[model samples]
Target: MIKTIIFDFGDVFLNLDKPATARELKKHEISNFSEAMLQKNREYEKGLMTSEEFVEEYCSSFPQLNSEVFTGSWNAILLDFPKHRLEFLKRLKREGKYTLILLSNTNDIHIDWVKENVEFFDEFKNCFDGFHLSQEINLRKPDAEIYEYVLAQHGVTPEETLFIDDTSENTKAAAELGIQVWNIDPAKEDVTDLFTIKKDLF
Candidate 1:
């Protein structure tokens, strides 16, 4: 009776180099992610801070790095979105078997990068019944409230929804709220194999 499938944008569908950002930062001698820096990121993800403010905060603190360099380093984690995944998603949508929703903890800059880099970004996005970006919704995963918001907004029962995310912490939170979850490992599995991988659920 799973009528809804909630997907995380990065890693789950679109490929992401999870450690690329840190690696890029290290090249610039910016290794430490202190508590304040993490807080700023959280605020940015929650849409509490504007992109200008977020970039400015980082650029100001690291005087050696300009906005462009810092932005590039920050966006290094985003990689290619496989065409097969988009095809899979489109097929799923065409089937009309379930409500497809996309939920991601993403910021303005990374989203901008995706739009510019991913040729079929909009087409892929059109498949989702509801597209909830953390920055737009002002809520993020692992925070319970965001899951509640999506469930409430869509009138979806947690038990009847499957959430796929590459992050364990995010899946754990959704599972706690009674949503079925696939905590996918990007290295080994691909979202395009949804039917074969989670056949039992289907």
Candidate 2:
């Protein structure tokens, strides 16, 4: 039986334009992220670097772009949070059948944008019994340690937890640790149909 539910924020609950950031950057003549740039992004997501520091690193690399432009492009990945998803989550929270946990790999600037743009952000956050943001916790997903940390912190057995994410890499990582998962495809499905889609689990 699944006693706890772990959800990924991007695409699972909130909508995202995954290519928007890269597309935006290309417009500024920044076509690709080098390995070092990617590492910096990972560091930022892990809270190893401050937002200011992250922005400065990018600005220094691309001297033509200022902090504001880079920040805007970075945040272009976030789209809208559909109201129906929030309603489904709220209903699930009201039922209180399982321990609800939100585990996301996100940076400060992205979350700051979410807080400002998503009107019901606070209410959505309150639905979770445990809300673990990667940057806030200094841990990001697709890593065994982060999943272990969440399980230990919440005192939930991996076998009794269901992890839902849009990324297959993340879902595969959790599955390897004995946690059940749904690697949802946002293009074909909506999370509101969770129960029907994963009926055997329920």
Candidate 3:
């Protein structure tokens, strides 16, 4: 019996524009964002580096752009977390039908942005019994360790959990570990759509 519902934070609970960083860099006359630059950003996401450090390193390399501006631009991908999604998750929590969890492969900078911008961070945190972040855990999706860690921590059986994520690769990884997953397209569907099809989830 599906007892847990895990949702990915970015591109699922909240909006994330993957291309925003490259776009923002373009505005600063940084036309060539090398693969190495992207790797640095991912390392930050994995908690291997801090946001302040990232800004310093990036600004040092660019030398022309202000580090604060770089920080804001790096954070531009984080748009708004709509009220409806928060309400939906809260409703599910109130129902007490499933163990609601929020899992995301995210970083310090983006989290800092959310803490500052999303006033309801406490409310959102209150809704989830388990909030697993890749950085804090030092484990990320597409790797079995993350899924294994979550399942172990929650005592949840893979067959009895439904994982929803915006990234195709992430959902695929969870599914490989035996958790039912939905690779949702936010631009194509919304949160309400999941509840409507809940009966077919198992």
Candidate 4:
């Protein structure tokens, strides 16, 4: 039985344009991210660097790019948080069947944008029994340590936990630890159909 439910924030609960940031940056003549930039981004997501320092690094690398423009392009990936999803989560919370936990790999700037844009962000957050953000925890997903951390922190057995994520890489990593996972495809599937889609689990 699935006693605990772990959900990924992006693409699962919130809508995201995965290619938006790259597409936006390309318009600024930043064709692709260099190895250094990718490393810096990983560091930034892990809370090794502050938002100011992250923007400064990019601005310094591309002298023509200012902090404001870079930050704008960086946040282009985030889109809307649909009302129905929040309603679904709220309904689940009210049932009090499983321990609902949110596990997301996100940075400070993106979350700040979410807080400003998503009106019901606080209410949505309150639905989770445990909310773990990558930047705040200094750990990002697809890394085994992060999955181990969540399981240990929640005191939940891997066999009894169901982790839902939009990325195959993340879901695969969690599955390796004996946790059941739904590698959801946002384009065709909606999270509100969780019970119907995985009826056997329930």
Model 4 clashing-pair count: 0
Clashes per model (N, Cα, C within 3 A): 0, 0, 0, 0
Q: Candidate 3 on 10-40: residue-level lDDT in tens? A: 8887888889987998888887867998888
Q: Please list the residue runs of candidate 1 whose C-alpha ends up more than 4 Å from where it truly belongs after superposition.
A: none
Query: Given candidate 1, what's the lDDT at residue 147?
Result: 97
| Cα lDDT for residue 160, candidate 2 | 92
Model 2 agreement with the true structure over 1-202: per-residue lDDT tens digits: 8899999999988899999999999998999779999999999999999999999999999998899999999999999999999999999999989999999999999999999999999999999999999998999989999999999999999999999999999999999999999999999999999899988998
Q: Can you list the residue pairs that collide in candidate 3?
A: none
TM-scores, each model vs. reference: 0.98, 0.98, 0.93, 0.99
Model 4: colliding residue pairs: none
> Could you list the CA RMSD of all candidates, in the order they appear?
0.8, 0.7, 1.5, 0.6
What overall lDDT, based on C-alpha atoms, would model 3 receive against the true structure? 0.86
Better of 1 and 2 by TM-score: 2
Cα lDDT, model 3, residue 117: 96
Higher-TM-score candidate of 3 and 4: 4
Winner on TM-score between 1 and 3 is: 1
